[model samples]
Target: MTPDEFTATYREHYPRLVNLARRIVGDQATAEDVAQDAFVALLKATLHDEQTVPRFLSVAVKNRSRDVLRHRKVAHKYAPFETFGPLSAEYALSVALFIDIIAALRTLPASQRRAIVLRTYAGLSEAEIADRMGWARGTVKSHTARARASLRRELAEVA
Candidate 1:
């Protein structure tokens, strides 16, 4: 597609895309990143089937968000070695909280985590999520349900 077309598409879909990214990544800032990344990808995107532009964008945005979440999961998995050489007290406290939250999130299976993130963080409808994640709608629903149950079990002791 042309640059103008890409821009038009991005403007049209930006809000929903942000919502989708937010659900997948679990934060406003990260969601913005995902959405922005989608737009960037769209700018340079060249699909063999130009008719499916929207679908391509939807999948790209979701995949970007998933990548962000996967990165977080990986980071969380090895957080014990994270360091701030000149750490202030507040920084140390923040790092500790980050580690704890990551540890808790790690309790869930990958599918459940992605499902929860896509539903809650990205604010995507189940149908949209199913399309983006390339999963059956019912499977997405089941994963979210399981994620919620797992989250409850993990967070129950936190508070």
Candidate 2:
């Protein structure tokens, strides 16, 4: 793609790509970084079919997001104390609650988790999620419903 073409593609897809990455990684800043990296990688790659660029970028973001999540898990396992820094009591409590929520999200099945995150965090409507996920609207609704109930139960148990 030429510079102008690339710019247009970025403008069109950047938000959706960032939302996808955020759903996977659970961090907006990191999601934006991952999406930018994917676009940069696409710019570097030589493609025989330019039409496949969007799909390629999406897959690239997904892979990068998974890699980041894996790295975070391993690092947290080995160096849990490194994450703790100076913070007010209220801030620390909020962080703790966020961690608990993330843990609850992890317990969900992959489809349910994705549905919940895409709906709640990414703020995508059911139809949008259905199109992106290649599922029927009903499937997205079911997944979101079940996931919400599961999360509510889990959080209540924690409380």
Candidate 3:
């Protein structure tokens, strides 16, 4: 894509892509960085189809988000050394739970994922999520409820 096309695509998909990354990595700043890096990578890539740009960006964001999560897991696994102590069982359990939550979040549909992530992770109210996602308040509620139910099912074994 040309620079102009890339700019337009970035403007259109950036928020959703960032949201996607946030769902996986669970950090707003890191999500934004992942999205930005995906755009940068897109700019460097050669694609014959403009329609595939969004897909490309989404895949790139997901892969990069997983990388962030992996690196975080590794850092947390070894964090006790920096603190001059051994890793606590509680800390290890929390890390595993976090990883499970992210995996469960990924299994949700897009609307449900957006709703729950905004509500739980980003700490947005239902109205705010509706406004950001361009859905009705009721729709947001429904999505959030269903998403929560699905997450509960997916993570029940963990608990």
Model 2 TM-score?
0.52
Q: Which candidate is the best by lDDT?
A: 2
Global lDDT of each model? Answer: 0.82, 0.95, 0.92
Ranking by lDDT: 2, 3, 1
List candidate 1 stretches off by more than 4 Å: 81-159
Residue 33: error of model 3 in Å? 0.3
Who wins the TM-score comparison? 2
User: Could you give candidate 3's per-residue lDDT for residues 1-159 as a string of tens digits?
Assistant: 667877789899999999999999998999999999999989889898888988999999999999999998888888866565677899989989999999999999988998999999899999998898888999999999999999999999778
- Regions more than 4 Å wrong, model 2: 80-82, 85-159
Compose the digit string of candidate 1's lDDT tens values, residues 5-56: 7778878888898898888878999888888888788777667886787787
Ranking by TM-score: 2, 3, 1
Candidate 2 residue lDDT tens string, 28-137: 99999999999989988999997898899999999999999999988888876647567788987998899999999999999999999999999999999999999999
Model 3, CA-based lDDT: 0.92
lDDT score for residue 72 of model 2: 91
Candidate 3 accuracy as TM-score: 0.50
> Each prediction's TM-score against the native?
0.48, 0.52, 0.50
Pairs of residues at least 3 apart in sequence or in different chains that clash in candidate 1: 19-122, 22-121, 22-122, 23-117, 23-121, 23-122, 23-123, 24-122
* Candidate 1 displacement at residue 18 in angstroms: 0.5
